[model samples]
Each structure stands twice: as structure tokens, then as C-alpha cells.
Target chain A: MSAQPAAVPHLEIDGVSKRFGETEVLRDVSITVPRGTFLALLGPSGCGKSTLLKIIAGLETQTGGHVRLDGEALDGMPAYRRDIGVVFQSYALFPHMSVKENVRFGLDMRRLDKAESAARVDEALELVKLGGYGSRMPSELSGGQQQRVAIARSLAIRPRLLLLDEPLSNLDAVLRKSVRVDIRELHDRVGTTTVMVTHDQEEAMSMADQVAVMAEGRVLQMGTPEAIYERPATRFVGGFVGSPPASLMKLSRRFEGGWRFGEIEWQMEPALARRLDAIRRIEVTIGLRPERMRLVEAGTEGALAAELRSSEYLGGERLLHAAVGQERIAALVGGHLSGLPKPGEPVHLLPDADAVMLFDAENGERLDP
Target chain B: MRSSTPLLFLLPAVALSAVVFLAPFAWLIYASFKTQGAGSLLMADGLTVKNYARLVADSYFAAAFVRTIGLSALTTLLTLVVGLPVARLIATGSGRAKGLLLALMLVPLVCGALLPSLGMIHLLGPLGVVNGTLKLLGLTTSSIKFLGTTGGVVLGLVQAFLPLMVLPLVNTLSRLPRDVEHAASSLGASPLRVWRRVILPLAMPGIVAGAVLVFSAAFTAFVTPQVLGQGKIATFGTVAYQQAALVLDWPFASTLAVVVLVAIGLALILSAQFDRLLRRRRLAA
Candidate 1:
């Protein structure tokens, strides 16, 4: 049974800041995590995402401000006292303990009776689908199995908040996909407030209910994955979140209520047109998702003339690379489509107006489209 | 191909071991059975058990054997008790502090056997600095006698071999996975519990190796016991010295040497078994 629900937010990070000597690692970062939600702190490496996770877990103390869980201030509280479960990137399972003993460690630390601890250990192992491996040593198991033992060990305590730091990074590509789904399922089954730190954008988009994009030791944007991918607030987010990265090109306004780049000119959607009006003829960067660019027949009037550069056949989808003037761009095409243009062949590249994203060239901030 | 190249290089070492160690040990066993009173042992008057019987009948030899074993056992135990905490501190302490402690531990090793024994005698003698300090502190009225006792010999032996016990332990403990300790702490285990459940079990191999080295060194120790024991406490090595040099009984001394060899061989075998057990447990964990 759950304890009485406290009045405070399930997890509240207030004005958290951290500095390692002269280097400012995290600056006044804060977020409120609702109970039973899976939140992913997604960023590039050296972006302070992992540092913030450690701060929330009490493994690393903040230089300023505080963290609270269930109405209790967590400042000065050691990691164990905070009653949070953590799965590190390295797994960190005790090499001297069997899978069973490792899972039961937290329960034993809580002074649970032997019978109760054994049952919980069994349940935890079953939760991670490692029930038959109770007597095996950590080193004897495969990497993924060792990771499962680590997860089971953390879950044995039934912690209220689970903190995971790139928990699937150590797995191979195939294992990472399956383990990612397992982690999401585990989160759903426990219904515990969870925060995961990861540099893998797809992992965050697939596993997290909400994604917090971080860069340069600060949170640049935080929203659902749809918001993060579709309407990224900063150029960094737009460039970072998508595969083949949203292509950015310099564009200027034409006199006839459309945008121009190189030899191409096209009418913009009215909503996007008004947003570009503020900057009028001044040059700006336009972001087009790979899926939003298409190859049309040459001399299609508004479309830009381009030359095919390269193509990669990726099982279900073919990634086509092309050049429009001096700007290199990519388009994702169906893999089964056979009439592909060869390298150096002229083609027409057209942009989907609704999917176009505009940013100020000087600062790379998203324009208000 | 790569593995066999190293094996070929190891052949010389194996051949040398067969020629040097095994051949001599076989010859010693043969010599132990030869008759030796009337003439040279090279011309044996038939193989006999007389040397072994003489060794058993000698009371002084028996006392020395028991004393050597007891002293070695005590020294090993004391070294373990003292060295384990120091080694753990060296392994886990801050970088500068660990370096300083390591340097301090090496001082006795640099001083070696003779100088440190002389230093100990000066400190433990009747009118020595220790007695003078005790007198100044009003802890005693007269000097306390420490020389000519087993305690003095043990103190000397421990000081000489302390680094042997600490270094191996520090090496192994320092290499232990630090993540294991953090995992235990994050699981709500206390610091003492973490040490008991994680650190000590992982460090058992180094502790066993240290114990064996300390025991063997103490068993064969001559100079420190000679200086500090003041001719009162007899050990197997001292008895062998008396037979070979002072008494001029080469056959009897050789027999005593054989006994020392057997005792040391047994101790090494037992220590090896302990090391294996520790290794297996580490792997199981």
C-alpha cells in the first residue's frame, strides 16, 4: 500500500546549480517532476544532463538551491537516506554477490525478514526476467543480464523515484532496442516517478513521456517528444533531435510574398509568411526536416534545381543526399522505390511549407512561426 | 603462435629449475640418509636413519624448532592485525595522504635488518630512551627490561617485515572496484557493513600473501633475534648456526637445515591453499 500522498510535488528541483572549480557545469537548473511520470533529460555529451541527475539522486550535491521529494527537503541528505533507486551506466553490481544476493541487498539493508527479502528478490528478478539466474555470479552473466540484475537490485527496495543514467548505452544496438522497451514497461508497471539521463535522442523520444533538452549546462527546452521534435525552440534542439539533422539553409524574403534562397523562390504558408515578415528581406536560416524535402521532376516551376549526391539503402528507407546550389541537403525516400537518380544527375528539390522552420541567422533563435 | 613463443622463452627457466632446485633437493634427501660420524658423508657406510634420530633426541634442537614456529605464527598474526588497517587507509585515503603514508611505511624497509635492530635495542635497553621517557612521565620508578625476551625479538621482526605485509595488501585493495563500495552505500548499507561485506572479502588474497611472506621471513630471521633476544631466545636458524659454526657439527646442522626447509615448505603449501580459496570466492562473488 502507498503511504499518504504528501502535499508537496513528488519531486521538486529548485534553482539547482553546480560548478567544478572554474568550470560552470550546471546553472540554476530546476524542474518539477510529477508523480509516476517518466522524464528523460536528453542532451549531447558534456551538457550537464547526467550532472543534474546525480544532483537529484543526492550522489552529487548542488552548489546552490535544494531538491525535495514528497514534501521533504533533500539537501544534506545522503543518497541512501533519500530512498531513491539508481541504475548507473556501468551497472555497478557487487562482484562478490550472486544475482539473488545482489537483488536482496537493499532489502537486507532495510532489515527486512529473511523470508520477506527472499520473496521480494524473487519478484524483482522476475520483473527483470532474470528469475532463473539467482545463483549465477555477476561476471558470469552477459552484459545485458548484469544490467538486469542491477535493475532488479534497485527495484527490490520499491523506491519511490528511480534515477537511471544512460542505462542502455552499454548494450549493443539490438539489445538496446529491446532493453529500451523493457525499461519503459518497467516504469509503467511500477508507476514510480522516474528521471533518466541520456545523450541518445531516439532513446529519449521512444522511452520518455516528456523530454527535457539540455545544452551548455542549461535546459534549453522541456516538453513532450512531439513538441521537442516538431517545434524545437532553439537551433541546437532542431539540429540535435533528428537523424540526418534538420537541414539548415540561408534564405531571404522575395518581394512577392515568398522566400528566396539561391535561384529558387517559393510562396510560404500564411502563418509562416507573417512570422518571416518581421525580418523581411534580411537573410535567415531555414530548417527543413529530411522527411519534409522531396525529389520532384526538374523544371517544376517553384522547386529548386538540385543534383543527386549520394544514397544509402537502410532496409526500409533510403536516405538520399542532394545539393541545391552550394547547400547539401538530404531526403528520406521509401527503400522499395526503384527509379532512383544516379549521382550528379539534375533533380528538383521541393520543401513542404508547413514543415519549414525559420531561425534568425545572427543568434539561431527560432522565429515566432 | 603468439602463445607458443612465450612458452618457448619459458623453457630455459623450467630447465634451470629442474637442474638447480629439484636436483639439489634430491641430493639433500640422499645425503640425509648417509652415515656421517667416522668419515666423510660422501663415502656412506650404508644408508641410515641416524641423523634423523639424533635430531629428535636433541632437546636444544627441539626447543629451537618450537620457538621458531611459535614466533613465526605470532609475528604473522600481529603483522596482519597492524597491517590491514594501515593498508586500507593507504588504499582509500586521499592521494597526497596515501603517498605520505606509503613513504613513512618504507622507512623501516630502507633501514633494513641490522640498523633497525640496533635502534630497537637502544630504545628497549635498561637505560634506553624509552625507559628515560617513561621515568619522565612518572609511569614507572625504575627501567623496564625488554631485551632477552621473545617480545623484543618479535617486535624487531615485525618492524623489519611490516612493509612486506602492507605493500601487497595495498596493491590489491587499491585495485578493488570502487563502484562496489558506492553501490553498497547507495543501498543504505553503513560504512562498516560495506567494509565487512565488500572490502575484506575482496582483499583476502593480498592478506594471505602478506601473511605467508611475513611468517616465512620471521621464521628464518637471525640477525634481529640475535641482537634483540640477547642470546636467551633460541630459534631454529640460531641453533643451526651454533651447530655449523660454534660446535663444528656439519651433519647435525644439515639435519636442522632440512627441518627448516620442511617447515617452510608446509607453511607455503597451506598459504597457497588459502589463496586459492580466496580467489575462488572472489570469482563467485
Candidate 2:
């Protein structure tokens, strides 16, 4: 279910800005995660997504801004008092502690009765499917198992908000998929406000109901996964969110009734031409997803000529890597296609007219159609 | 042959150490069993257990042994209590602060036992800087008896060997991930609870290592105890020094030295056993 903003915000990170000396790590970033929403702060390294997560978890203090949990301002609250559970990228399981002890740590801090604590530990471990691993030390578990134990440990606390920092990054590819599913299912069952920071686009798209795409210390876009994928607000978001990502090329020259990029020409519709004319931009960037463009025979009419560089087989589909001038673009063509060019051969790409996105060349912001 | 080649290469060093070090140690053990004829410094022909018998029989030596053990234990504990925070600061601090703290910690270590012990004299002496400051501040009308006291000797020993505790602690604490503490905190552990549950448990190896090192150092320490004790506080080391160098009863002194060496060796073995026990599960895992 989609989280509506009209509902009371379970976690509100308002204008949180963090600076380490002169370097601004997070610049006035803000996000409101509604109750029971699984939100992903998706970005590459040094994008301030992890920093924002830390600020919310109270592991770090924001140089400026207020973070409120259930409308109560969490300013000056130590991480212990924040009642937030953080599952670190490394898992951060106490190596000296047994799985049971690690899970019971928060309960022990609460001074819960032995029977109650033991029951809680059992419940948490069962949730993570590690029911019989109580007496084992953290060092005894596999990476995936350790990750689950970390999740179990955090869940044992029944924390108000749960923050996961790149939770599945350490796991193998196969384990990552399974663990990702487990985490999503756990979140659904737990129904706690969850925020996961990850550089993985697919992880965000698949697991999160809401995804906030971040870049260069700023939130570029925040919406449902579909909205983020279908309509990225900036060129950065457009290039970042897709698999075999969208090919972006800057087009400058304007011909008779279309835009010209070196030897390639994109004929504009009458309505689109009027919009472009109104903006009066000499240079504009265009984005095209790999699946939206088809590989045609060289010298085809209205097709952009490209030099085929490589091809990768992907079972039912093959990816064609081609270069149009200096810009490299890929086409996800069917493996059963009739014609496929060898590396270094000339090819033509025919793009779907309606799927093309226009962006401002200077700022990389998407221009409205 | 290839594996044995490395051992063959190690032969020279082993042989040199055996000749230079083990030979003297063997003689020391042998001498501990011999005794001198009356009014003579030269060792007598037949071996006797009188030296060890004297050590076991004398209540004075027993008291000295107990006092020495107590002082060493006290020094070990004091250094641990004081060094834990300093080691943490060095481990967690960055850039200039870390470098500065490390350099400060190393200064006394490089200065050696005698120099720092001398420095401690000025700091803890009755008419020294502390007493002078106290007198100036009108805190006391008379000088406190810091010199030739158990407290004075222990203070000197702790000051001399705190780096022993801190170095191992820093090595361990630095390797300890900050995330572990954060996880504890995030799991509803207060700062104190985090220390008790996570930090102290993880730092056990460092604590044991530092304890052993500081204990061994203080147990056999001569210069600091002798200088700071000033002949009034009779520790095992001070008594050993008095017997060997001042009393000139080489055989009796050698027996005392052997006792110290045995005690230190036992401590090492005990600590090694502790380490093995801690590591058994880890190795199996």
C-alpha cells in the first residue's frame, strides 16, 4: 500500500544539513516517511544518503535541522534514547556475544524479566528464521546468516524506527535476492517505519514502496518506485534508476524541423517543436532507455547511425553496445533478431518518438513536455 | 628440506642467544642452588638447598613476596583504570590529536625506567613539586611522606609501565569497530551499558595482555621501586637488589632472582592459558 502524506508522519527529517568542516555532506535534505512505509534512500557513494540515514537514527547530529519521531522532536537525544534500531552494512553483530545474548541486549537494558526476554529473543529469531541458533557466537554464522541475526537483534528491541545501512551489500548475489525478499516480507509483517540506504537501484526499485533518489548531497526525486522510474525529475535520476541505464546525449544543432546531433537527426512534432521554440535553448540533453530504442539496418531512414562496439548475450535478449558520435548507447534487442552486427561494424538505432525525454543541458533538470 | 631450511637459517640466531643469554640463565639457576663458605664470596663445591630453604623459612622474605605481589597487582589495576580511557582516546581520535597522544604516550617508554622514575621523584617526593605546590597553596602545614611508601612505589611503577597497558589496549581498541558500540546504543544500551556489554567484553584480550605485561614489569622492576621506595618500602625487587648488589650474598640473591623469574614465567603461562581458553571457540568456529 502506498503511504499518503496526509497521514501522521512516523519519522520526519526536516531540513537536516550536516557538514564535516567545510565539506557539506548533506545540504538541507528533508524527507517524511509515513508509518509502516518501507523507504529506500538510494544513491551512489558519497551522495549523503547514508549520512541522512545516520542523522535520522541519531548516530550523527545534524549541524542544522530537526528530526522528529512521532511528532516528538529528537534533538539532543542520544542514540540509545532515540529508540531507533540500526542494522549496519557490516551487520555490527557483537562478535563476543552469542546470538541470544546479542538479541537480548536491548531487553537486558530494559531490565525485562528472564522469561519475557527469552520469549522475545525466540520471536525475533523465528522472524529471521534463525530459531535454533541461540547459543552460537556471531563468528559462527555465515554472512547471510549473520545479516539475519543482525536483523533479528534489531527487531528484538521492537524499536520505534528501523534504519538499515546497505543491509544486503555484503551478501552474495544469490543471497542478496533472497535476503532482500526476506527483509521486504519482514518489513511488511513488522509494519514499522523502515528506511534503508543502498547504492543498488534494483534493490530500491524492487523492495521499497517509496524511493528517494539522491545525488551530490541532495534528494533529486522522492516518490513511489513507479513514479521515480517512469518520471525522474533530473537527468542524474534518469540515468541512475534504470538497468542497462538510459543513454543520455546532449543535442545542440537545430535543422529545418528537428534537432541535429552530429550525423543523427530527431524530427520533432509540430507541438513539441513549438515547446522547444518557446524555451529557445540552443543545446538540450535527451535520454532514451535501452529497451525503447531498436537496432535497424545501417543507413535506414530517420535512424541514428552508430558504430557497434560490443554485444552481450542475456539468455532471451542480447544487449547491443553502440556509439553514436562520442556518446555510448545500448539497445536491448531480442536474441532472435534477424540482423546483428559484429564489433566495429556500422549500425542504426531507431528510437521510439514518445519515449524520449528532454532535459536542460546546463542544469541537467528535465524540461516539461 | 624446504621447511627445515627456514629452521636452518634460524640456527645462528638461536645459537647466539643460547650462548649469550641461556648460558648465563643456566648459571643463575645453578648458582641459586649453591652457597658460599663463611667469610668467603666464592661459591662452595657441594650444592645445597639452604638458599631456597632460607627463602621459604623466612617470614621477612614471605612478607616481601606478598608485598611485591600486592604492589604489582595494584600497579596493574591502576594502569588499566587510567590507561583504558587514554587508549580509547588514542584509538578513536584522528589526525593531529591521535599523533600527539601517541607521541606523549611513547615519551616515557623511550625515556626508560630510570629516567621516568627519577622524574616521578620530583613529582611525588615529600619536598618535591607536589609538596611544594601543596605548601604554596596552604593545603598542608607539613610535607606528606610520599617517598619510601607503598603508594609512592606503586605510583612510580604505574607511571613507568602505563604504556604497556595502553599499547595493547590501543591495538585492540583500534581494531574494535565503532559500529559495535553504535549497534549496542541503537539496541537501547546507554553509554555505560555499551561499555559493559560490548566494549569491555571485546577488550578482554587487551585487558589480559596489558595486565600480564604490567604485572610482570612491576614484579621484577628494580630501578623504579628502589629509587622511589628509598629503602623503607621493601618490595621483592628492592630486596633482591639489596641482597645481590649491597649484601653481596650472590647465591641468596640468585635464589631470590630465580623466584622472581619463576613467578613471572608462571604469570605468562597463566595468561597464555587464559588466551587459549578464549580462543578455543573462535578457532573451532
Candidate 3:
């Protein structure tokens, strides 16, 4: 972590943990979001991302630790007193109220003047680009439209911190793509310190300034998208952050200074070579991105012999599913790789040296750089 | 084929309804206009509004009509005052708590009206448990009169009609999304404000349905008032019973019955109208 004199973080989650009876849902999870920064709590289902978000929102209380907003510890404060706005996965719009009334709810609760509330409602509606939708009911709107109304309702309150939990998950694929952009633009315009929870890697990578990848009950990695993607600190993260995840292959130490797997020997980079002494048997898994693996013409140095298992024709790229010893791996080939070897045919697999990531097979931790 | 099969499934219910509901209602409307002895004691004999006219002129019948309406209104209000919170509690409580509370609420529902009245009489009547307790506590010198009073009748009606008011509201409240309350709270609304703006409006259908059901049940309550009133509190049903069974004026009794039926029918119509109006407003909003 760089010491850039962090701006008084708008929100701080310190050692926050939650348990439902005997089930530990969140375990000592902590995150900090500076003002106007978009932080995404990204994780697979049952990973406690939503639980953590709910705790920060005060919808669910943490069993231990604390959450602070704008420097005030949020102990014993109810969700309403916390003044944080939340957009739920179900949108949670008041089905009985009109769009305008729904937008004005928080303002009404605050006892703002009618004229002021109306102005804020209009402004927020326009911010979500649904200005003329005030008179409509949520049931009359499309799913995406309802989601925008929910966003507008929260934004109308002018909350300092906004939380969204899978707000775009209900939309169709095309709408999800477009709504992601809308959400990013909305965050920029509103400038609210925002925290969103999503399972979609693409959505998190594209929209979040800081992506916190969580698994089980803890955050495995938290960094900028590029940092989390290109140099994942953990094997779970390297496998989670990309679409066609990083591949793993088992290797053992050779009698020589290099590593050997099957009948092949490969020299390690200096940094990786030094760590080899600390590693007992050099039994390690090599992580490689599919895009990083190359299908070289036979006789290439530093390439392992393999047999093609199957091939898939993606629009702009062909994916070759091949096997090295009993381990299966995918390699992205050119769109016109019609001459690629058929299943059961011999092939050579080469790992781009710079792209290969090594993890301790026993612990699944990324080898320290 | 699919449509015809469903129609076939519906045919028996439709036939039963025509025989059970429509036929009786048609006969009641015809008998309302008939003369007393000339009418086939079981069926209509003549077409006349004389019985209705006589009912309008009779002061006893008029008072009973007013008392019936007033009792129904009071019972409905009291039931709402008691049932709403209980229903809300049952709706929001945990599964075990809801089941326990529902069972407690249903104790009154399953008890026969006469049985409850019998219980109340033993508890509230002169020299009964309440008077004895009051006397023992130094609150009273002697047993107090409770058997022949309107208060006893109203209390009995409230007990009899309470489940009708609560069940529908509970069903409605259970179906209401808890998200609205969470949304309101997240937006800085107080608990009271959330109930006022979100929960109450969403649960209106259930509330209205419960109120209507309570009012209808209390209006026609027979045994509770008869046993509790002990001949003093005269509601519409008691008046009809007196005229037909005691006074032997079959025509006047039938008139009172017809009037009560009309009033209940009007209430049902109003209930339907209110439900429709609320639905329309919901749609419009």
C-alpha cells in the first residue's frame, strides 16, 4: 500500500464481522473508501459481499469491529440515522407510490420544504435521465427503468455515501452493459463515495476505482483493476479476476537449478529462482493466462509437447483446448487458425515468460515477487 | 380442448351456486313483498310492499336498525384498534412467534359464540368472578349488574368478530414486502414514518377487507347479543326474533328480516366498491 497521505476516508470498515447463529458469514473484513471513489466488493455467491455491504449500510449489524462514516463511528446507529442510501438488488421501490413520491420519500422524512423536496426530486430524476417518469408507477416501468428510479430515489436524498447491491443484475444482458455505463457516469456526476457489490468480474473491473475481491468470508485482494488483474496477489484472485481464468500446471524441482514437469526443464527468472530454495520440493503450480499461452511451431525452445484436445471457434479468436500430461489447458489462437492441430494430434505449448505466475501448490498463495 | 376442460371443472361449482345462492336470494326478494298468512308459509303468495312499509313506520324496528348499525360500527372500530397491531406483529414476527400468536388469536375464533357468552357471563355477571374479585379488592361493595347491558353485548360481539378482523389483515401484512420498510429506513425515515407512508398504504387492502368482514359479522351476530343482552339490548336480529317467535306477527318479523338482509347486502356492495376504488386509485397512481 502506498502512503499517499490518504484523504480522510469517507467510509472506514474496521475488522467488521458478522455471524448468523453458528454460520460465520463475514470474518474481520475491512475496507476504506475515499470521497468520490467507487469501491466494488466483488465476490462469488455466499462470499459475504452483500453481508458486508448491509453491515456498512446498518441494515445488518456487525458482530464485532466498527464502521465509520465521515469519521463518526456508527455503533448502535440505525440505518436511517446513518444517512446512507442503499439501492437493493430487487430495486425495493415502494410499489404504491408514484415515481415522484418515491423520490421525495427521504426528503419528506427529513421534513424538507415541499418546494425544496420537489426541486431535489426533479434534479435527481434528471440525473438518472428519467425526468418525465415522475408520474409513473414502478410496476408500469421496465426493469431497467425501475432500477433507475430506485437509484434516483436514493440520490434524491443527497446521501454522502451510496451503496448498491447487484443493481444491474435484474436487467437483460444488453441492458446490463448500458446500465453499467450509466451507473459509472452517475457516480461521477453525483460524486458520492459509492460502494457496490457485484459478482460480475467485467462489471467490477470496468466500473470500480478499487476492486475488493472476496472469497469465503475475507477479502483476498483489494487494489486497482489493473493491479488486481495483471498481478494478483493470491491464486484465488488470479483465477477469479479474468474471464478465461489463469491456468495452473503442476511442476517439480529438477536435480539441476531449474524446474521440471513431465520431461521438460525450464529456467526460472532470477526472482523466482531465489524463492526456489525456500520452497522444499519445488512442487508448484504454474499460472498462465490463456491469452498468454502461444501455439508455437514444433521445435521451439522452452516449449512443452502436448496433444490438442478440442478446438472452439469464437468470433474473433479460436480457443484450443489441449492437454499436457493429464492437465488440460486452453490457448487462444488467431481467428484464422484453421491449420491448428486436431484433437489427439501433437502440439507444442509455450508459456510467455513474463506472463507466467507461480503459486505454492500446498498453500495456493502467489509466489512473492 | 384445454379451455373446455376447465369449463367442465367449473360447471359443478356454478350449478351448486345457482341452486344454493341465487334460488334463495330470489325467494327472499319475493317473500319480502308477500302478505303474512296468505303466503305459502314457505314461499311467496302475493306481491306487496306493505310489510316493508310497516317496518319503516315501526319505532322499535327503527331503533333496532340504528342500534345494529351502531354496534357493527363500534365493533369494527374496536376490532381494528386491537387487531391491527396484533396482525402487524404476527406478520413481522419470527415463524414460531407468529404461529404462537396466531393460535392465541384463534382461541376466540374457534369458541362458539354461546360458549364465549357463557364464559363472559360467569366472569362479568352479578356475583360472577369479576364482581367477586372487585368486591374482594375493595373496589365494590356488592355484585354489579352486567348481564342485561349494551356494554356486555358489545364486548361479546367484539370477541366474536375479532378473528374475522385479524386473519385478513395478517394475511395481507404477511404478503407485504419488508423491503419497503428497509428502503424507507435507509432513506432516513423513522419507524413511524415508514409505517405511515409505506406499510399502512401497502396493507390497505387487507385492512379494508378485515373491517368489512368484521362489520358484516357483528351486524348479524345472533347468539352473543341474545345471551348477553338478556332481553334488554335490542339489535335488528333480536327485534325480528321477538316479533316472529314471541309476538306471532310473522309479516312484521319477515319485514325486519328483509330490512336486515338489505342493509347487509348494501354493506357488501359498499365493501366491493371500496375495494374497487382502492384498486383503481392504486392503478392510477
Candidate 4:
């Protein structure tokens, strides 16, 4: 669309839509992945992230629109001919085939010569750090090993695009972190245009170069992980993309100089007040991220009166639960800090003014400054 | 103590089978070794190998044995080819279609072999639906021979035993995750190759199970062959029936029955060995 700007995108999804009987599973979703970029379609369950991945992989056909790779339209190409590899959540290894055989299957389909096929199988196994595990059956391996084998099998094909559907969801929590790092490293080494669908924000943030946050069959925002995290396009994106997600509080009537949040009328900076004046709506939602807010003395200026309810020690940081008016918000404090307020005691929460976000109360869309 | 309780729960079933099934089978085996006097139908002499000797010496019995084996094999293959799609439909299909297909499949089994075989008579008789349609269409001037033919008997047997193949196939095929097939296709295997490399190999256990059931059912089936064969075709079932009921040679008939049972046992053992060999082949490959 940009008149051959730079290199063509390795994978392009153009206004794709999918409908299953009466239910619309995906609606006008589109994204493009530059070659070698790892993109994660991040969303909660039933968000159509997996459906979009399946459409890209050619595992499922889209009801409307087109998907292209390297400027070539792949509308009617069968999955087998698309040269896209998919690693399913279950691993989906041929229980009958050994590790080497499973990896060699794609090569066999291409009718590659035996020696080269065997060599590629060995190369793939080595890449996944399962070099000596060729003889082992899938059932014989642990969950982590099986997942690695699945990745190896997909990589052995040397596909133009690689799709993973919640690859680490089936693993136990302990193995998930290591596998997550391994997948990112593998993507880097292989340099294939890869798309991974996951609900785990940490996995998406740590692994993918670009993250697309989706909800209710539509993509809300698509950008670099930092961009999505720092400047979320919608209130849902703000609440969905972070650990201890940003808390949203309703804003009341505007006072003499600033708006009222909860029971307290907090004064706003002149620059921030000017931005709020742009929106004509009386009702607005303010987003305060837990990490961006801190505890201050009860009588501190420009701070909301709150009561400390509980604290959760998380190794290096402690998450404190505070109640202000009818709303409850959390703040992360240093674990080493001593003499924190006891539960039921009144405290003050001072949010970083620069980091504060405002959203339209009616539609949940972020109101950009 | 844990084992004893299971045995205790199994006692009635084992005892019932021992009384009703094992006792009759034992008697049949015993009778196969006994022979009647030359003039009387009643047993007169001690145990001997003459019935078995007579069996080995008879070319007619040998021909019947070969025919029955061929028929059973053909029936098994046909049922597999036909039942596979239907079983897949049942396994993957949802709601009323699956329930209806399963219920339809069970109709033959529930109706008993005799009823279906009797129904087959009207379908495959000289003036049956097929021949009548052929004649009415002017494809033939006269009715084509169906009764007392191998093809007719095979048809009847297939209709009767198809559910045997489908039930196990559905059980196994349904247990297969849809992901593996999707994975195969995404990994560059064509639809045909997916079936060859993934689906069929995985469904081998079901295929073996279904084949054993169908093959054994077809091999020892009586009513279908008797009613459809119309006395011209002499399968093991029909021949045994003839010797037992018409000729009234109980010892010789028992001998035939014993041989059929042994053949079924041998088939089961061979299939079990085949399963082991298949596992070994997969491992070694």
C-alpha cells in the first residue's frame, strides 16, 4: 500500500474476518509482520487471537479478506503448500514417530534426499538442544522436551512463517519461563517471521518484538511491546497488558481548578488540566498503574486519602492494597521498606502526574493528550 | 485384599460364562473326538481322530474352508472401506447426525442376524429390488442371479457386521486430537499424505480391532450365509449347519465347529502378533 516501501512484509493479514454460523469470531482484523520480527497476538480467552493465528497459518480459512507473504497473495493456497509451520499447544507430535522421524516428516513430504533429510533432522534436534534424543518417542519425553521437539519439527521445515498457538500454556509454570526464553532465542536464530498467540503478558513482553492486543474479535492496538505498555490505545489495552494491571477510577465534577477523583478534589497541573478541557464529557476514567503510584503521608498535598487494607510481599517488591472512597487500588512498594502502615490505617496515594491516563467513560477508549 | 475384591465382583460373570459358554464349548471339543456307529446317529464308540481325519481327507471341506476365508477377508475389506467414512462421520459429527448414525448402525445388531438375513432375501432374491430395477430399467431382459452367489452372501455379511468395524473405529478416531492432523498439513503433508502418514497409522489400533471383530463375525456367521446363499453356496457355517441339522452327523458337525473356533483363535493370535510387530516396526523405524 505504501508503493513498495523498503522490503515487503514477510506476512500481511488484510482486513481478515471470520464467521462461524451465527457467531462472528474475528472482525476486520489486520496486521503485518516484517521479516524476522516476532509478533504476539496477546489477549484473554475467546478474544480471537488463536483464530487469527490459525487463519495466518492456513489451518483455518478466513471468511473474508486476504493474507499475503512477501507480496504474494496466499488466498487459496492449501496449508501444505503455504510453507507455514505451526506448533500446536498439545505439541501434536506423531506418537508413532520417534523424535528424529517427527522432525524429518516435513522433509519426507518434500521428498528430500535421505542424507540431506537426516542431516536437517540432526540440525533441528541440535537447535532445540535435543541432539541425542532422536530415538525417543514423544510419549517417552517430558512435557518440556516434547514441546521442544514440536518446535524442532516446525523449524526443520524452514518455513517462511512460523505460528505457535499458546505453545507454553501446556507446560508447568517452572518450565514455562525457560521455554519462553528458548522460543525467543530460536526465533532470533532462525529469523523466520513468527507469530505467537498467548494470554500471558510476561511471555508476550519478554518474547515478541510487536504485541497486538485484541478483545471481542477485533484488534485494539498493535505496536512494539513498550509502545503498547506505555501508550495503550484503549482502556482495555491498559488494563490487559500489564502485571497488576492499571486501575481505572471514575472522575466526578470539575472543581474550581481540577476534577474530583473519589471523595477528594485533587488539583491538576495546568498542562494536564488544559488536555482534560479538550474532552467535553463530564464523566471520565483515570488510569493509575500500581508501579506508577506511591504512598505519601496522610496530609500530603494533591494526594487522595486512602486506607491500607493489605500487603503482599513479592520477593523484591510488596504490593499494597489501599481503599479510597468506593474504589480499591494497589501500589507496589520496595520489600526492604520497614514500618509500613498497618491494615485499617489511613494513608495517602500520590500518583505520578506525568504517567496518569484518562479514558472516555462511554466507550473505554483512551483520550490522548 | 484389593485384588480379591475385584475377583469377588467378577465371580458371577465368570461363573455364568463358565456354565453357559465354556461348558458348551468344552462339550463341542469333546464331541469332535467322538464318532457314531455306521448305521445309527447315536454315539457308539470311544474317542478317535477319524472325524479330523475325515476332515483332512475331504476336498469339498477344504474348498469350503478356502471359500469361507476368502469371503470373510473380502467382507472385512469392504466393510473397512465403507465403514471408515461412516465411522469418521460418527466420530466427528455432532448432535442428531451422530446419534442417528449410531442408532442406524445398531439396527442390524439389534434386529438379530436372522431378521436382516431374511430381509436380505427380499433384497437379493430373483425378483428382488436389484434385479427388478435392472429389468425395469431395461438393462437386462431377465433377472440376474444373486441368490446362492458369493457376492450376495458377502453383501449380507457386510451389512450384518459393518457396525462391528465402525464402533471400534469411531472409538479410536474420536480419541485422536484434531491438532495432529492440522500439524501434519501445516508441516507440508498434503491431505492424502496426512491420512497416509498420520491418521491411518494412528488409527491402526482401531483398524486391527475392527478387522478382528468383522473378520471373526463374517467367518462364523450362519443366518446371513444360510438365508442369502440359498443352499448353493456352502460356507463353513452353512456346511456345519448342513452336517449337524440335515445330515444329523453331530460328531462331524462338532468337528467342523471345533475347527472354525480354532481358526478364529488363530486369527486372534495372529492379529495380536501383528500388533506387536507393528509396534516393533514403529520403534525400529
Candidate 2 vs candidate 3: the lDDT winner is 2
Ranking by DockQ: 4, 3, 2, 1
Q: For candidate 4, lDDT tens digit of each residue in A1-369?
A: 123455676788899999999999999998988778899999999999999988888888999999989899998889999899899999999999999999999999999999999999999999999999999888889999999999999999999888999999999999898888889988888888789999999899989999999998999999999999888888999888788888888986665546876666756556657667788668788788999887887666557777889999999998989887788888887888888889999878888777778888889898875
- For candidate 4, the docking band is medium
Summing lDDT over every window of 10 consecutive residues in candidate 1 chain A, give the lowest-scoring window. A1-10
Off by over 4 Å in 4: A1-7, A254-257, A262-264, A267-274, B1-16, B132-142, B283-285
Better TM-score candidate (1, 3): 3
Backbone collision count in every prediction? 2, 0, 0, 0
lDDT of 2 by residue, A1-369 (tens): 456457557788889899999999998888988888899999999999988888888889999999998789998899888888899999999897788888998899889999999999999999999999988988888999998899988988899888999998999999899889999999999987899999999999999999999988889899999998888899999999989899998887565656767666655445556666777788888888898888776565557778899999998899999987778888899988765789998888887666677789999998974
- DockQ of the candidate models in sequence: 0.46, 0.65, 0.73, 0.73
Model 3, range A1-369, lDDT digits (tens) per residue?
223246656788989988999999999988888788999999999999999988888888889999988778998898898888999999999988899999999998899998998999999999988989999988999999999999999998888789999988889999999999999998987788899999999999999999999998999999999999888888888888886777777888887667766666655446555656566555887787888878887787767677888888898888888877677777887778667777999888777777777788887888857
Evaluate model 3 with DockQ and give the value. 0.73
The interface root-mean-square deviation of each model, in the order shown, is: 2.0, 2.3, 0.9, 1.3
Q: What is the TM-score of chain B alone in each candidate?
A: 0.84, 0.94, 0.86, 0.92
DockQ metric, candidate 4: 0.73
CAPRI-style grade of the A/B interface in model 3: medium
Report clash pairs, candidate 4.
none
